[model samples]
Target: MSDTTNHQRIIALEAENAALKARIASLEARLQLNSAPPQSLTHTTPTATPELSAEEYLRYGRQLIMPQIGLPGQLRLKNTRVLIIGIGGLGCPAASYLSSAGVGTLGLLDHDLVELSNLHRQILHTLAYIGRPKVLSAIDRLRAANPNVTYIPHITALDKENALEIIQNYDLVLDCTDHPRVRYLVSDAAVIAGKTVVSASALKTEGQLVVVNKPTSSEEGGRGPCYRCYWPRPPPTESVVSCGEGGVLGPVVGVMGVLQALEAVKIISSGALEGQRAPASANEAAAGSPGTEGPSKPEPASMLFFSSYSPTPFKTLRMKGRRADCISCGTPSDPALKITASTIPDYDNFCGPGPDAVLLDPKDRRTVMEVGEMIGRENVVVVDTRDETQFGITSVGGSRNVPFVLWQRGGKVPEEFWRAVEEEGNSADPQEEGEKGKGTKGKEVVILCRRGNDSQEAAKMVMEDPRARDWKVTDVVGGIGEWARKVGGVVEY
Candidate 1:
């Protein structure tokens, strides 16, 4: 097909997909209200049913009653070994539910501490338990939730030092860390270890989940597709933010985390929802095989992605197999997946923190507006550095109108404009020279102007000193115009 024709086709298909999602949302809401499974599969257990201990029995009572997850399925859950890497927001819910559901043995890895702010939706930590190691706290909380389960906690971040060793021991691996770098690294490690991986992500109010499991050819035994099949590389530096600094609706994560848990359970179980089809809802044939176990529960190497957005809705997309040119996973790296032992790759360097970090300044009044809402509680200050003409649109709600340039004629800055700005904040505190850069190096400053050029340079200039680099330095992503369309804050007219 011609390129234009293909492009048109893609657009049409995406629209169709969007429509289908809307319909799915409607159908799902109805399904919950009706308490229906659409189509329930019946699996008969053998005469000699395996005896589950008291804890296992109580924990899995609900799942076992379902014909699809009867005695055999419960056994499957008991025998399954699922490893959850990084127990942050996404990991917390996935791991919690997995443990509560009796996932037998759960292996967790994370090298961080819990802060009070994490309680907003992290769901794993409480204010009373703040300032404790995350891995340690997670294990304790998980164990208490379901004493029948076994908990294995690795108090270290996954890297070249332990990725292989850690991932190889589990039947499935769940990627819940918020770091894209770690996500990619874990994907490669799972592919190499010949294990099934279910990856999920939640940012702001949006979330994505993917299932990867490549099939072998007729001759050479093959592993499934890795995460690289879709996302090729991380976005440029300065294009990322954290939930700690970027406000997120706590329950938005609640929904995504629950979904992640469901996927993890489904990945390990050999029942209806795990890999099997969800049955025909409206005479629509299932996406995969008849009784086709979805990618969630695959033969060996498998992957699944599911994402949702609040103020919007929930959507699920499943992709199968590995890409040939996946920079991290493919024919060129099969031997890497065949590691005789578990290992962690050098994640920091692989993820990039090199000197050439691209610093983007998406500064604009609109940018300030979008970010103001993001850090609403912090009372972050926005500095307007636009010229007069552009200042007409600047929103002063979250900003202080400190135009860095006062032009006299022909776009030329007035005399001592820089000196005035340098000495302007002094009125607040003349004795404290260091305090002059209140929002610049210490408190919090988001430089904004028209088109993001002047503000970008201004922010960079303020942070030129090594001491100021420790201060939060960020350029609004996508410039002000883009921010205006996404999140509406306030614009000074």
Candidate 2:
């Protein structure tokens, strides 16, 4: 029972030991594969640095070879995700450069439709996409520019309901939106998600850029100040004019967008964008906050301002650090003011009174076509509510110009303008009135403007006039734009 049985047991033990060694080797190999950088989901096999393909290397080699953005920085850019909030003036250039620079993932968010009017500034879209949703058009253009990046298009408006969820997926956010409510929304969402925000705004000949919500140093205690820290709330609606209303120089917006792209690139690459040369001026100041008091010296963050009209267009000023009581990012000093996504204000209300605040009843609005049909009827008068300068440029023949700005400021169309309108209505032949029984002796006032928005308020103002209580007042939906598009006429803005 001794030597033979002992030899058999030793052989069995040796076989078990060999099998265990093989199993351990297999497990170790599997672990190494799992720990490597993620391969492309489109790939059928694992690869080293699969994020950067051969074609990509050829495309980005010039930038990859730079000292500041070498291989490591290029890889960081490839892994970064950026969300561009709007595809209009600022977003067009920002998205374009970010994609070309090899950002790994891009989220395009816009709800507007491309129009012929947008072509001059929104370079991401073209005449071919005159009626397409902006995000889709942007995706098509961006994909053509760079297929290496992943494009996520959100073709809806970002509101309180969806802002946080959508923004949390991106490492950084570019607030290219035009609306104040949207600016605040993006800022708050970025803060809550702990993401950096690069914001840019352009109006007429001037533009401003700022980076917000960057991580603060240990001494600062918490994150940097958000948009709200700079602007506690949006300015009044009448005071805040958009590029659409006031008109902007295309190059102004383009320059701002490019700067926004630069900020995003610098943030992702972890490189200083500051130049070695001295600043242009010692007295340069940052763009001032509209309503709040600002620091005497440059703050932790910086705001860059540009103007086409200025001799020295670019100016940078430091922004204040984390506000101890910021409702969005919270003060490092005060815990009670700490805010969450749920605690954020209804952005629409905080921005200003919304459309619902002065919402007109549906019955009070007439389609542009319906108003067009009523144009030749007896006792029906068309009031063009645009300013006098706008009315002089282009208008429907025989329509009276009420000049909405005057009316808004507690003035009315001069008594003579109203008298002439009544005379024109009365001049319609009785026989014609008989043929078109829709005609009436009572005044039927139809209001129209560049777009339908101002017309509603204009109609309401005319209705409440002591003399016009008996008159029938209605606003033309889509205003002159619909009239020009559907009924046929020149719509020169």
Candidate 3:
């Protein structure tokens, strides 16, 4: 062959080699993904005796050696099934530990998809799985961590219709969700299904945990108190804050999640299941009769509070056992409190409606487009009601910072804010303004915040104040987030 022909062949061969490498990489990734537990293991039938493989023995050897969780406890873990709801911050660590400890079956249930914001605290999900269902992402990580364990993914929210049916299959349920309605729903469903629940929540450097509806003999006060026994009514919608709104430290939530796993593992190995007994010292075993129960005692109903900033980070509040008057767990003569699938109360109604963005009349609310026009106009005064930190992050130019918290505390707008408004009103060019520049009527006060809800509240407060009777008070319809999307000037965060 000629030299030119040989050079052309060399280039073609190099291109072919690159294509083959890419194909090999793709196949390897597929094999790794498919190497997870078989389809049969997804719904493994529990046998009377669950035997562990040699690989599992080595995998869980560290935890198995502990006297608290020896051979018997390991087998109990092999047979126990746990369902974790809301695979976000708390669920991520809790599931990781449980699967690593060799729990036979884990049910991962979540309705949300993985977002970029969830990665800091939701440890199981990564950048690769963003926009995917959280449960599927969690399953991928969990299966890789412990292939011996069975993982069942429920890629849907737990509602009254399906909560009981799904919860019935698991020995225990973890209420890792952040919302109040879901918490109540989980507790009610767990109570109805006769399952124990380890519920936990974390936000803003603080976390709270509780194990409720623990299965007990008739003598043990007919099972511990359900969540309703402690708080029958949900907190006011305004009082409840989410992680997105209030913010949370990543480690604070991770700590709460790890503790939840610890509680779950303890519950499983505590002789609560058939053919399993809490391990005892040799002396105690020798002293007791053959039929005598082991030293396992029911953990008293209690709430554990953790604050990362506090010197005493952990505090336990002992709670009363089940109440006779509890609407859900009670023996009230009224039958309406009892919740079944068909009788489950509408949680949205029970919790009350969420914040109303349209609380004010149309005339009193201005859209972001209108606000964009008003920016830098001396006659229009924009007051940002978000906190100082948020105000510093990104804000409309010439807008005054008057946080909503001041209004929430029943305080009037500060003198500085009025001074700024007065300066803006005085600086208006009468000749340039025309008819609108007549008297204080020319000045307009526009309220804005992170979201429109707080601005509406603040606008109402400002309107009610006697000081600004002549001024036009209105709030931006969708606040900074809307402005960021529509106008592209301010940062939404």
Q: Which has the greatest TM-score?
A: 3
- TM-scores for all predictions: 0.58, 0.72, 0.79
Give lDDT tens digits, candidate 1, residues 1-493: 9987885575455445534543464455445425532222233333223235555666677787887666656655755667888777877888888888877678878777777657777787776556556665776687677766666666677877678878876777888877777777777777676666777766666666665543333112345566776766665433444454334667766667787778666645553233322323342222222233433323433333323433436544444455665655555455564323343445566565522243553332235455757453342555666545445654545455556544313244333333443344344346556543443334455666544545555666656645445455455543444455555554422
* TM-score of decoy 2: 0.72
As for lDDT, the candidate ahead, 2 or 3, is 3
Off by over 4 Å in 1: 1-51, 214-223, 271-312, 318-321, 332-345, 354-458, 461-493
Give per-candidate clash totals: 37, 3, 0
In model 2, which regions exceed 4 Å deviation?
1-57, 127-130, 238-246, 271-299, 331-338, 352-358, 373-381, 407-445, 465-472, 490-493
Q: If the candidates were sorted by their TM-score against the true structure, best first, what order would they fall in?
A: 3, 2, 1
The better candidate by lDDT, 1 or 2, is 2
Each prediction's RMSD over C-alphas, in Å, is 18.0, 16.9, 11.0
Over all chains combined, what TM-score does candidate 1 have? 0.58
Best by lDDT: 3
lDDT tens readout by residue for model 2, 268-322:
7752211111222222112111112111123367789998899998898877666
C-alpha RMSD of candidate 1: 18.0
Across 1-493, the per-residue lDDT of candidate 3 in tens digits comes to: 9987885575455445534543464455335434433222222223322255667767888987898887667766865779999999999999999999988778889888788989989999999878667887787788787877767777678887899999987888999998888999999888777788999999999999998887655324447788888888888766677787778999999999999999998878765543223222343233232221242465677899999999999999988888887777777678776776677677878786664436788999999998898787656889898888888999998888887777666556666566656656666653433333244464789999877988887788778877788889999987898999999878766
Model 3: weakest 10-residue lDDT segment is: 36-45
Better of 2 and 3 by TM-score: 3
